[model samples]
Target chain A: MTDTITISVDAMGGDNAPRAVIHGASLALRERKNTRFIFHGRQEQIAPLLDEFPELRPASTVRHCETVIAMDEKPSQALRKGKGTSSMWMAIQAVKDGEADVAISGGNTGALMAMATFCLRPMKGISRPGIAAIWPTLRSDIIVLDMGATIGADAKQLVDYAILGSALARCLFDDDAPTVGLLNVGTEEVKGLDYIKEAGRVLTEASGSGFTYHGFVEGDDIGKGTVDVVVTEGFVGNIALKTAEGTARQVGSYLRSALKSNLMSRIGALFATSALNALRRKMDPRTVNGGVFMGLNGIVIKSHGGTDEIGYKSALSLSYEMARSRLIDKIGDTMQRFPIKVASEAPEAEPEANSA
Target chain B: MTDTITISVDAMGGDNAPRAVIHGASLALRERKNTRFIFHGRQEQIAPLLDEFPELRPASTVRHCETVIAMDEKPSQALRKGKGTSSMWMAIQAVKDGEADVAISGGNTGALMAMATFCLRPMKGISRPGIAAIWPTLRSDIIVLDMGATIGADAKQLVDYAILGSALARCLFDDDAPTVGLLNVGTEEVKGLDYIKEAGRVLTEASGSGFTYHGFVEGDDIGKGTVDVVVTEGFVGNIALKTAEGTARQVGSYLRSALKSNLMSRIGALFATSALNALRRKMDPRTVNGGVFMGLNGIVIKSHGGTDEIGYKSALSLSYEMARSRLIDKIGDTMQRFPIKVASEAPEAEPEANSA
Candidate 1:
């Protein structure tokens, strides 16, 4: 018999709390029979949902908590008020205390990141943590990182992200030598900032030693699957991710409007229902809803706060796969074995007196 | 009666060269009867094509040129080799010498920007030039800028883009106080780099003084029409633009595959041909093919190099509108009227000793 992978879930987190979390866990259990859950919230709220899934009853347990992090709470506020007794914190603490292999929360991103960092801490030799998403592309899925975990990154931080992302890709894709690319404005050698250029040089020198570094990639290259990992500072990465999502939604809306423009088109749409259903499945955002927080000592998957049960189940599945792969240990090993040279910061662009 | 808006066209610039360029100009003339064209390329190549349209013969003039800038030539290389005699250079020089009201080219982007900067120079009190695009949205079209003109910008340069973009918006959208936003990873006050925050503060201070500053906007806001203009550094801006394009194209491909998946869907598609045609029009990249180079003293619209007659005509139409609006002078007047404080450069993130 295989070992049961235990997941700590923050049941009081998300828009549709307790119910969606319990439902998602039950769904996950249905797909993976050797899975166990530790739901953290009010026992009274979660116990009734568990009763509905008798098959999941033997594999699940609940931990009572006094407080829950609010959806819009600032990171600073959440850290101060919701640190110890909150379900979000307790869920992360379960991973820290070795009670669970991974923690999954559909909470505010800022609060979750703050809690995860405070509880699990950054890995050895790493200064900051990054959030990564599995981006769906035309060719295949690629890993994109720093999806708003932090704003800016220095050259060393960028190289660190490359290592972290490469390691994650290795665990998820089972490809040891995943091709990595730094997202930049252009693919040319002399295109970006001093930090990006320096990181490119560092990756070039260390290429064959560990990961295969495929120089620079522009924005379009991400959807084209130009590399296995696309690394950038959080600000650009987050914008790119959201922009792609928004574009897909906008186009979907346009298609809907066009398909209903005339009487003949309305009949055509009815006949093409199955084909349209297949198209909707191909474009479903729920299939890729989880964002994995990397560069930490433990695994934490942050589900979208407003996602449905299907989305939450997808997140849980990703967390199980990551825990099974021992992603944190793999990242630690890769980073420790292969070191990169950080770019020397250039002297400040000299302060010009206010030219008004 | 419209004082004949003379346009200098680089007939040798694009992939289809004189053929597509001449056809596009004929199309433009049909829409705006008072428009006149000064074509720069081999007279033998353009004269025959112009002969196809009898009415265009009187309103068009062709200037013979010995050199043509190649599609793949680097900006720096093009600037060096094709300085004066090349068709692209001569087209811009027409605006510089008052021989034409505006210049339009379907040449390489970098080469076009380099030539425009060299020939037209930036307006007074502006350090760098930015490229602005009119993006179609669900609510209305919005203007997004710094679409890969230069790499990065300080707080001051970003504000300048705000001014330039707003001025263009005022001319095109006729909104006296266009809402402007600085693109960031998040809409919160405490996210993104120090420069973006500083720009936000500066713009906030100057809000009622000129354009309406709408604070920070995230990536999805661009398509949602959250602001009249979205200003960002070139790297992020370029990526957002290209990512949206790639996503739209990717979704289009998916829809095509879905419609052909079954015989019933095939029949459905045939019945919905007109509606599908309308949908195609809405998503056509050709309708938004031009990228306007702002902060320059002259109007220069860069059309996609691979565009056909339809796309080139769109670029020409934009040039006509900008020329009629006198966009260059409007931007200059706005900048000169409301000048804001430029940021004092901060010390660069210190170079850490190589930790490899």
Candidate 2:
């Protein structure tokens, strides 16, 4: 018998709102019979959606919230105004109160991260929480962290991310000792900023401490699956992620036009429809929708605000898997077993800048 | 009558050296009638390759150099050992001595940049030179600069890149007022590091200073053609460029497998061969081979060392276009017209780190 996993959902978050959230929970509940949901949003909006899913209604409970955080609201402003009442806040609050195992939101990333950090607080020995995104690669899925959870990171923080990311990799991939690589401008040992080199040195010293450290990897290595976890400051990591997404979209557009250029090609498209659909399924962003917030006291998975029901269901599934794997305990255990010792000459940590 | 544009070639630089260099020059000369070449490498190797093109033999002169910089050599090591006698050094030296209108090298990038900076020197008021790459977008080609010529950039240096990149944009795209954008994790003004925000403030203040400032653009905007020129530090810029390249390759691989999965798909691929070929041509990396060294006194174009003759020709063509357009003078004029004024409170410049 499996343990029942309860997920707190920000029902009024995301573009599709109550309908997509309720339907997504229904889909997720259908697959995992032991799963339950506590939806936090306005009762008027969510009641009708709940009625439409009779099966989900029995396994779910609604906690009405007065306000919702706007998608474009600044992190600080959202934190100030929506501290206790907003659906986004209440969803995360459920996790803090031990009412739910995980909190999932499709609200603005900055707001979601800010709320998660404030409500759950950072884990012991962790200064800031990093968002670890699962990237699809040619070989296998790789974990990339500091995906815009914070603007910058220092050598110690980078090591923290390494431990956090490797823990997540172990949880998701069932790998006992994941290979980690420091993201740099080049693979050469002497390239990139001082902080990166310092991080590389520390990671080198800490090799076989829960994870094996590959010296350095360039941005291209993310897609090549050069390592199980690619660690970097949030700024570069975020840019690389978005850039890859943009490039994939650009190539898809080119492919679409190529297949529709002429009558013969259109006929070819007809014959290759099934194959192309299979390819589409392989490349679909919905399958990989969750960005797990690492270093937080409790688990919080952020789903893309613009994603549909299918994407939301994927996020819920990720939350379920993470909850069952004891991710937080693993992270704490890794940090305790292999505490990072910063070199005396390592550069001082820079002040954090506000990020959205 | 057109003025004879002389280009210095590092014949022993690339993987298929002397042969590809001489052949690429021959191909470039056929298109641009008023072109001449000064090849710098081993006379024993270049002489035989030159014999194959009778017309090119008369239009080219060979300068012998004994030492060749290895691709894996560090920038500082290459600079110390191959300063005067190396083929790469002599090629840039030709441009400095007015023996050539432009210098072209398919050598190791770090060695080429180091040699170019040492021989030709940086333009006045410029701290370090940047490498501006022509990125293909859906609407048109856009210029992105500081493609790993240096590691980190200050606010002033970023503004300098804006001016430099726009000048390159004007020269290549024939745009009088090219729009420029600072690459950030998010388009929001409050997002990213302090230096990026400071750069944004300065650019906003200097809006009509030769180029129109489009504020901040995320990584996705590069392919969307949201701005005519994207300015960033080399660290992020290099990563974004390589990540995009990797994603395109990944997608292409998926497409290939999809079109060859079964007999029906294989037959479909046969019918769509012409259309697919057209798409392949559009996506070819060779078409955009050059990375122009900006903020330098003389023009230097770096080609991919691993590229073949056709790719080398594209770099040569880019050099010719830049030389003819008076790119250096344009950069100087832009600086003179609208000098960047960084705020007093802006962060101090970080020390340069060695990159390869």
Candidate 3:
């Protein structure tokens, strides 16, 4: 018998609410027959949506939750007001209570993170929790972490991110020893911040700790698939992710305009429609919808709040993969194997420098 | 009579060296008939390259400088060894001595910035110099500054960048009140670091000083052309620029593969050749090769070290425009008009938070 993987979902969270949530689960269930869903939200809204997918209705259980966290609610305020009864909180609580293998939410990222951390608590020895983004590259998908979960990570925290990110790569990529790289301005050893340099030193020393340290990688390397895992503080990671997305959209717009500019090109686009579809599928943000929250006791996937059913399904699939691979255990094991020792003295502060 | 714009060139700096420099100057001269060049490098190599374009020989004078700063050389080490005699140094020296209106180098970025600061010095109140790149956007070009000239800018420095970037935009875009935005993780007033928040508050009060403040903008807004100027510290700005470049290249690669995937697609590509060519031209990095050094005493341009003659020519043309527009004087005027007052007390530190 196939092992059941129960997913706790905050159904009333996203822009599309219970519709996308229930529809997404039905789509996921079609592919993964062993999955069951615990929907946490208003029973009235969720029950109607579940009826639309009779197959999903048989495998789903709706838990009543009166409070819904607003998309724009401050993390602190959301935690204060909706700590126990909110749908977002109940979804995460199901995972903590062992009722669900993992939790998925298409809600406020900050609120989801705050609730997840407050409920699940950070894994032993993990100081900061980070969100790992699965970035598409020329070779394959690479894991980039701390995508604006928090700002200003120290050297120790960066090293922690390295381990967390590597564990994520292992689960997603099915690699035992994934390669990790510290994101920097340049590939040179002497480039970037003090914390980055210190992280490099520690990662080098802890080379065989379930991941290979690929040294420093620049922003371009992220798209180039230079390493399996790329680690950085939240501030830089968030900007890099958004900047790439923007550039892709910008180029996509240019391509659309170019194809429509002339009669010949329009016919050409018709001829190349299938090929263009393949390209579109490759570049589509929906395929990479989930941002996995790492360094926590349980797995939580944050889907894009504005994404539709198709995008939410992608996030669900990722959650299934993570749960089946025992992602949290892997992270915990790596954390224990490679305990980061604080340096007695700070690394020498080098004068600020520029790179080409 | 057209005023002649003299450009100082680091002839033996780039990967192509003297040949690309001389050829580029000739190309620029063809367009802007009233232009002269001071080529600094090994005369023997430069003279032969200059002889290839006999028209350029009359408009150019070669200054023999034996030393050439290696692209990978440390900024401080390069300064210590090649201070006076390096081709890179002599190029900026010409600008300071008023022998040239602007200096253009495809040398080490760090070395160029160091020498430019040492030789020309910063403008009266500018603490840190920034490198501004002209980013191509949906609504034309927007200026993004501090592309890794230095890391970690204070609120005052960010304000200075706003003033400097606004001046460049005014000169290039020909709009007196160009809009400026602070680059952050989120556009919300409460998002990002204390320093960024402080800058936003100051910019709000100082709106219309020279440029109209548009509040905070995210990384995606850069490509959307949400504002005329996107001000960020060097570390984040540099990463964002490279990430965009990488994404564009990645998309271009994907497009090429898609068009060549099948026989019908290949035929379609042939039919839409001109439209495809136009798209290629728009996405070409050569069209935007120069990085303008702002907040400096004189105008300086950094060309991509790996770019060929076509790219080099683009940099030369940008130099001509800056000189004609009197970029330095415009910056000086804006800086004097709005002197940034330091905040009496540090802004309230907000708890670390996450953003979608």
Strongest candidate by DockQ: 2
Output the TM-score of candidate 2: 0.96
- Give the TM-score of chain B in candidate 1: 0.94
User: What order do candidates take by DockQ, descending?
Assistant: 2, 1, 3
lDDT string for model 1 (A1-356, tens) is 13789999999989988888888888888999899999999998989998987787999989999898998887777887888899999999999999999999998888898889888888877767889999988888899998978677777777888899998998888898999999887735244477888888888887864479998888888888889999998888999999988888899999999899999998889888999999999899988879999988899999998988898899999999999998987888778767565542432211111110
RMSD of each: 5.2, 2.7, 5.8
Tally clashing residue pairs in candidate 1. Answer: 0
Per-residue C-alpha lDDT of model 1 across residues B202-309, encoded as one tens digit per residue: 999888655899999989998888999999998889989988888888899889999999999998898888998999999999988789999888989999889899
Chain B TM-score against the true chain B, each candidate: 0.94, 0.95, 0.94
- Candidate 1 — which residues are off by over 4 angstroms? A187-192, A336-356, B187-192, B336-356
Model 2: how far residue A217 lies from native, Å: 0.5
lDDT of each: 0.85, 0.87, 0.87
Compared with the true structure, the alpha-carbon lDDT of candidate 1 equals 0.85
Looking at model 1 chain B, which ten-residue stretch has the lowest summed lDDT? Answer: B347-356
lDDT of 3 by residue, A120-157 (tens): 88876677688999999988899998898866678978
Question: Residue A243 deviation, candidate 1, in Å?
Answer: 0.6
